[model samples]
Target: MVAWLGSYGTSYFGEKAYPKPGAVIMQYTGLSEVTKHEPPTYECVGTRDGIASYHSVRSYIRKIKKNGTDAEIQIFDGLTHGFGLGEGTVAEGWINEAVRFWERQVK
Candidate 1:
């Protein structure tokens, strides 16, 4: 499993994004083409990741479900975005969830 922030258009949000119009357009356009996935996906993202907005994850999950997959998202309220799994972190909760989901899917 891998976790990463959608940093593709972050440059538009960076300084020198004059007029705001260009930045807005780029942001919307980027979101329009988010990735797609098949069913049986177990996805987790933090609400406070500050990287990809909640909307991005929500959109992806919806697309997965529309494709008939079992997609799950566990959004940690106080955690920053992209706090991915590690050996000795609270992210263990998410890892455990994924393992459980994988077991069920494989069964």
Candidate 2:
């Protein structure tokens, strides 16, 4: 739905990434065969990440859960999509939160 930044391309690290919902729908092509025996899933996404909205991730989590799997969703606040890229950027805190969440989940 980020067609607003078509000039910069869909991969732009700026405030716009996903040009349309098709970008998201296309990603689900691989999930069409998950059947019903998959393990629990953990999904972490940033609210401000235009590449993939936290809402979309939540929807996927719901689907996975409906199929009888545990799905954990973690949404970071005030962080951009690139929070996992740079060390000294604003995304560092989000990354730390994700790491902590992962550690807890793994244990």
Candidate 3:
């Protein structure tokens, strides 16, 4: 299992230096490319995020699902980039959701 955010999340898909993780918890990354053997993925991003496009992230999840790899996403309203833990925001509790997704994937 791996939990990554932003550029690290993007690299999780691209990096070939290490063995692939069984599941990935990705956040706020617009970089969307589905590898041949992508692990199950969980993602979250805010609609108001300036850095990562919400649509791009959705498309990425769709692509992953299309390829038969499990994927899920949480889109928060009126939130911006890097809203860490989303404390006091609509995105609060997103980590719990991501963890649940990770658990399902690993099981």
Candidate order by decreasing TM-score: 3, 1, 2
Error of 3 at 50 (Å): 1.2
Arranged by lDDT, best first = 3, 1, 2
lDDT of 2 at 46: 68
Cα lDDT, all candidates: 0.49, 0.49, 0.79
* Best candidate (score: TM-score): 3
Model 1 lDDT per residue over 48-103, tens place: 66766656866766775676656666655556654657335445567777777777
Write one digit per residue (lDDT tens) for candidate 2, span 24-106.
Answer: 11111113224344344555566677777777767766776799765566666765565554357543454455455446545
Q: Model 3, 1-107: lDDT tens per residue?
A: 23343224445567555645778787898677666466788889999988889999899889888988888999999888999899899999999998898889777
Q: What value of lDDT does candidate 3 attain over all alpha carbons?
A: 0.79
Pairwise lDDT winner, candidates 1 and 2: 1
Q: lDDT of model 1 at residue 15?
A: 42
Least lDDT summed over 10 consecutive residues: which range in candidate 1?
A: 21-30
User: What C-alpha lDDT, on a 0 to 100 scale, does residue 41 get in candidate 2?
Assistant: 50
